[model samples]
Target chain A: MCNERQEQDPGKFRDQIRQGKWQKSTSGACPGYVQANLVILPREFALDFTIFCLRNPQPCPIIEILDPGNPIVQEAAPDADIRTDIPKYCIFKDSKLVEERTEITNLWRDDLVTYLIGCSYTFEEALVRGGVPVKNYLQQKDPGVYISSVMCRSAGVFWGPMVVTMRPIPGHLVARTVQITSRFPKAHGAPVHIGNGEPIGITHLEKVDFGEPPVIDRGDVPVFWGCGVTPQLAAMKSKVPFMITHKPCHMFITDIKIEEMAIS
Target chain B: MCNERQEQDPGKFRDQIRQGKWQKSTSGACPGYVQANLVILPREFALDFTIFCLRNPQPCPIIEILDPGNPIVQEAAPDADIRTDIPKYCIFKDSKLVEERTEITNLWRDDLVTYLIGCSYTFEEALVRGGVPVKNYLQQKDPGVYISSVMCRSAGVFWGPMVVTMRPIPGHLVARTVQITSRFPKAHGAPVHIGNGEPIGITHLEKVDFGEPPVIDRGDVPVFWGCGVTPQLAAMKSKVPFMITHKPCHMFITDIKIEEMAIS
Candidate 1:
């Protein structure tokens, strides 16, 4: 009943995650299937967070959202369990990571709301398919992420700067890369800032705020795309005492294709 | 302070609505302007509504969403006031129409969240421009609407059959019409049902749940697109004590161009 058997196939991944055998990062599971960035917050903060995502769509293109207190991601995965399906979980208490568990069966509450934001990995697949060279995409490394100075439109108790992931596309193919990824608005569609890293207030390229340091060649242009770190940062700023997120790289893979999210 | 300029201009129409003038239905205010469907609910119901929109995107493509209790719609109109800007408003109490006002200034609440969903008017303009004759578009009549038995995906307390708007396309131009309208995801994107009316559980063509009767022809095929009414229908079903929406034929016009909504 482990997720290992379900790894290659998304349908079986649902079964394995349901059976509690797949307590592993879903990074390599279901290669073509869309993996979602999850954030489950209580009712008290649900409205502000939903507004936050709707306002700042680039960093938070919501793939699917579940009803308040509903464990089943009805649209993303009809029978999938949000509390136990995510391979790993990050629980935050008033902006602090208080626990890291394999499942949130004990933490489930009646007013909790789940948001499944689109991951950049979905578009990373597009950049490769468009014939652009994505180094981290090929090596299976998380793109370098940073807490940028780009502020998100605030909603009620939620407010934070836009978190962006850095990927160095060469100057020649930068336009092509942009054209390709622009089609997937749900997956951080296009590059927010193209060239100047310092303008977005990135002090240093070599030192990343999150993920591994990106590779930059002589002609490589450092392109930044919105990251899943956005809602994480927003939740931390609001300091919602009861908030849970998927562990980095440990996502909730849905039974949807990446192209299904491409502006459709 | 009347909307004195060209009726087809969005900016001019918005300018008039903002200055405490032109508070009538926005149906004929701006001919080609993309009118939006408004939904204002308390924070308690926002996450569920947002989830409902995400699940049923065809019926609810979002234009811009304002934060809970926030009066400003920054992206759609940075200086626009949500409470007084729209021409007409409908107040709902326990799913019943309690009041119809020009402004909600007296009802301004700290817990209210505003959502602006895309309207069919965006694509109706595209269709008209493409030489596909839209009788309603020319006659200044309301687009035909109906509440079909086809159930929309539910979220929390929101659940109901989708309300669809019918457009009769000549047999030969049906495919072309679909291709053109398909470009605007912000405007409901594409048709869900075509050719047959009863399959989606519609019994009569003229006895619509809302709006005018379609002018179906001998060589025409009835095409159905998800209407913003679906969300309102869902909200009414929730029986929430308090909810606010735009009056029939009344909508909020955005500064964004209709062409800007077209997908490449």
Candidate 2:
């Protein structure tokens, strides 16, 4: 099933996910298309969260924001429905994980505002294309995710520490890696920290908050980029009455091409 | 006085403006610093206005947003007060211009939120530095401003046509002009419509809605950039009960250097 998903058109692929025919992570699906992290909140909490994303763009780059009660993603994927297109959805009530479901049609409300944030997958692809090898991609595994000591600029009730994803890059290629990823600011842009992570409060690179342990070889520097998880953490910490997001790695694929997001 | 203003530090220049000693346009004042557009609104209208700016970044690039009830611009100018920093401000009521003043201290409210948006002066400096001539600068006059037929992507109650500032660039340097200005996305980035103004609803190059008439030579083409006036136009058209903005060409100078806003 995973093998068949590769190279499929975005719209057709969304149909497959919507119909419950595919339920795996969307990592390698539609290679050249953009995949986004989902965050749906009620209209009451929309303003602060939107401001939070605007202030902390490194961790929360908004690709498209759906109008209140609007289920269609007009900018990213015009024909797709937000409630049913993703492979999986997580419901949070009062900051606690309440349930994980395949479809959110039953829980959809008229005041819900959906935000599609850029995922690291886009920049990772750019890194590979630029001849800079990403260790986790080469190993076909998830990169290390950690809770850094750097606090995100707070917006209203949203306040929390920044979370970062780490990739092992060869020391010689760190500069080129930054240049390649910097083109796609929407996809978490440049590295927040490099070489030593201690300044950012990461004492142990081997012990990560999420994903597989990183493989850091000699002469390899652990490069860190702002992670999409920062917003989720902020949402949980803020204890908003209700919130919804895509299950980790189960992103919503958009019609936008990767090249279209490049700054140059 | 003009020579004294040039090369003067942002802090000192802001003090001069705060004391009502500098009532003229901010152009050429604090040459290397960033100048910003000011928008003040009550807390009730902040969310929608902010969302409008985020949705339409090219026209309304935000440099910093002060928290509700907080008048100090901590990010852009920490010691500066939003109510008194700019040389002049325009007051609007029910979408109509009611008054113009040097300070809003008497009208200040605890619920007001301030937004400092990027101004084109930063990019115009970049153009001059890059050897792309800006006709208005060469002529020692303000660039032409026009209300175009291009409609902005509406957010909530804010909706109106985009306003553009025109600069006649020599045909040979139009491409270079684009490359230079594109570096400052925070300050009205790339040209929205190039060469033909009629396609964007401009019938006469000699007539403009604001500022001086443009000077277009036979070999020069008119280039349009999304102007800061766009948000003000939207606010007026939306008929928001009350709003405040910097008077034309009288902008708030920030401590940030021009190079800081440039994208690599």
Candidate 3:
């Protein structure tokens, strides 16, 4: 793949996606860079949904919003096109998953507004660098994602349960784990619940809604962070006609340093 | 008149306001507690206006937004009747200022939605305690508010220039001033500009547009923060057929503390 070259950048990665040269997930493709979850809606629904994100910040941390009728994520990655940058895209109509496309270039429209939400990639890097092992990265597997019973603060048409990603951490390293993750505010900040899954309305860790199920040993605790899937869940609940999102790990990569978000 | 003795306890303060015996500014009344700038609009305009506030953080940092047709501020202060608790309110009809009433109980409609915006009162108190006194407070006056060249990040039905409140400080204390104010993120955190006023399009400090003219001492610097007034101006610019805001200093005071906002 052309992505095997060191010179591969967002522009190159985007071009690869456009040319059908890359049809794989975007994780680990560009190290030390930022990735975002996409949410595109009609101009009418965009305002209320964006407000819902801003109101409940820990869950829906913004990356950059595209101007109405503009598909380019001008601020996140000016050189890249939102329609073709990602390896895959999900198209939703009336909040139901309609189709998964390799390229959304055909569906792009002037009335559509795009939103880039911060992904958990930055904090996962921070957790690993702090001498704590993330089994998801170590085993090259997806972290467990679950739909929790915690209802999000609603605004206008957007309202739904909070979706969280869980990572099993050894009890001894859990304190240090939260302290490190706490530094990156844009990347879901810190764990909402450290040891207790029942309190946050997660009945069983083994049966998650998305990604692979986590392996919990004797002394390990399941740590949950607010996930980017939150906005998707809300969008789904609203059943807004004609919505689009980045499929699975096919995230849009940005040039911002993750450490720039580490402020007290 | 009752405010002098009412300052001794929260019981008397709430009692008087509830009884309609008192209608005064809530600034110094609720010392450590957070105060909010209120904007009440009908259901028809709620979505668009809410989105506008979300897109523009500096001018319209929202503390809480009630659900459609919900008059009570359940988050900020539960059981608080917003229609009458506030000392004063301005009613706008079809984009024209109509009435400045003490209590909006008569105007309350089933379709009204309320937005509690973060007031500068919280941060200004912190600034005073930190030895960086806001000039207007010392002179026993209101803040120096101006309609600036800076435009708000627009949302549907809400698009206008940002209005800023200026606080003049000594050139050397500028950095310390920012550090002090940054802590209160809920209350319009940090200054937007620290230098010349001309760049932000403020032609004359003497001929002030909104509040008191800033008293610029020798060697002092003029610093500007995104004022809550910006959202008000933007809302006014939209000329929504129906709307309401607390008149000037007569704000909605709550039990929330500014320091309590530092969740991280």
Candidate 4:
């Protein structure tokens, strides 16, 4: 119920949201824990989407995948229900946003498969700790997301352009930022492109596609990382019959500590 | 084909196998290229097997997964056919080894799905390059394999104990060995257990389960790594109706270089 208590325990934080006691974006809560983007699809399309994630790991680094129709997460957060843990959920039908709900307990079905994907929060924290400038982090808002010209490998029915989140890093820190962020491959790993937006088809950095235009400092270089919003675009472009995702900025907090994701 | 020729071109090596001019194990051939363990299954069991690999990446690090019934590998090796590229293939029926064939073109099915998993050879090369002693490299044979008590996270109809390959490292070099091998996550990453193997259910270091017994010198400590042979064990234990895998020591050589698998 309190900020201090939620920061200390991922379980307690989920319980607060599950019971409807707290319903807000989980951006800064549970600081050290891993936060994931949720994607729920029917078993019919699970294989294609799973393969899609496997092929496009930079954009879709999967943290944990629950069994079909199973809502309880065992690895990331033990006993956390995928249906009610997040503050908000977006229901998509025929490639369109059909509903927004706080909880989907009534909509849970046996054939629905839940996939917890790594988001940028984990690596962005590492970047900030590594002395890199993250303008969106300082402003406490989401970064600018763009649909790049790079197309993801098609798997069965899932295919779309990769979506990336841009962060302005000083020219001197671009290499260091890549080193820091590359440690967490599960959290969208390293930058897919750096400095030049023209090659990746971003003609204008300020002409935003999804989020607000980023604030680029005088001597900073723009670094782009694969974004979790990619699946949403894939879903819409493919016109999937039914799908569910966590609303923007509201993520599923897992019990895995950010340190556990770092490689040697 | 000469040894020097095969070492330079992975595509030429596969062409030799396709032409039946070479039918030997792929060990020490194509030094810098990546070699993968092959697993082919029916589409009915592909999802479960794919989930099994995703859940247990330490033992089953997948390098590339092909589209269902499509044998041409696009990412790992362009224009390479999975059926005839490998030197040998093992056919399993109801958990029993039914045949060992040079190619599976006759047995290829439209519903079959192929999974190319990371083998320890990639990391072993790095270890040798980093000045670590590798007994199997000197002996020109596969390392000792054991079935451990640690069970893999099961998915659907697939479940089995983890299989690990044992390497004897001198006490002074164990830490360095971990560091060197941990860089290549695609190649079974790092050692699962070091020093004594009793905790992981390996009582006798000499009693081998799958391969030749290792050579442990004085002051040497047994280090265990997740082996690619794990999927074969799972297939046998789960009594999968029909499955295909590359024979022991014989592997599918991919075009990806060893350095590409390294992480920061």
Candidate closest to the true structure, highest TM-score: 4
TM-score of each: 0.90, 0.96, 0.85, 0.97
Q: Is the docking of candidate 2 incorrect, acceptable, medium or high quality?
A: acceptable
C-alpha lDDT score of every prediction, in listed order: 0.83, 0.89, 0.79, 0.89
lDDT of 4 at B11: 91
Evaluated on CA atoms against the true complex, candidate 3 attains a DockQ of 0.28
TM-score of chain A of 3: 0.94
Model 1 chain A poorest ten-residue lDDT run = A1-10
lDDT digits (tens) for residues A1-264 of candidate 1:
223346577767766766777776665678767888999998878777887887788899888777777788676667788887887899999899999998889889998888899898778877888899899878778788998988988877889999999999889899898888888888888889998788888989888888999988899999999898898898898878888999988888888887776653
Residue A220, model 2: lDDT of 94
Model 4 stretches with alpha carbons more than 4 Å out: A1-7, B1-7
Clashing pairs in 1: A2-A21, A3-A22
Model 2, which residues run further than 4 Å from truth? A5-7, B5-7
The residue-by-residue lDDT of candidate 3 on A1-264, one tens digit each, is 123453356666678777877877776666666778889999878757876887667778876777787777655677578888788889999888989998888898888988889888778877887888998876767799998888998877899988999999998999998888877656777787777789888988999999999988888888999999999999889878889999988888776666765644
What is the TM-score (0 to 1) of candidate 2? 0.96
Measured on C-alpha atoms, candidate 1 has an lDDT of 0.83
**Where does model 1 exceed 4 Å of error?**
A1-6, A14-24, A170-172, B1-15, B18-23
True contacts kept of 4: 0.52
DockQ of each: 0.61, 0.49, 0.28, 0.70
Kindly report which residue pairs in candidate 2 clash with one another.
none
The digit string of per-residue lDDT tens for model 2 on A115-160 reads: 9999999998889989998878766678999999999999889999
Cα lDDT tens digits for candidate 4, B14-60: 99888887788888888888999999998888888888988999999
DockQ, computed on Cα atoms, for candidate 4: 0.70
Best by DockQ: 4
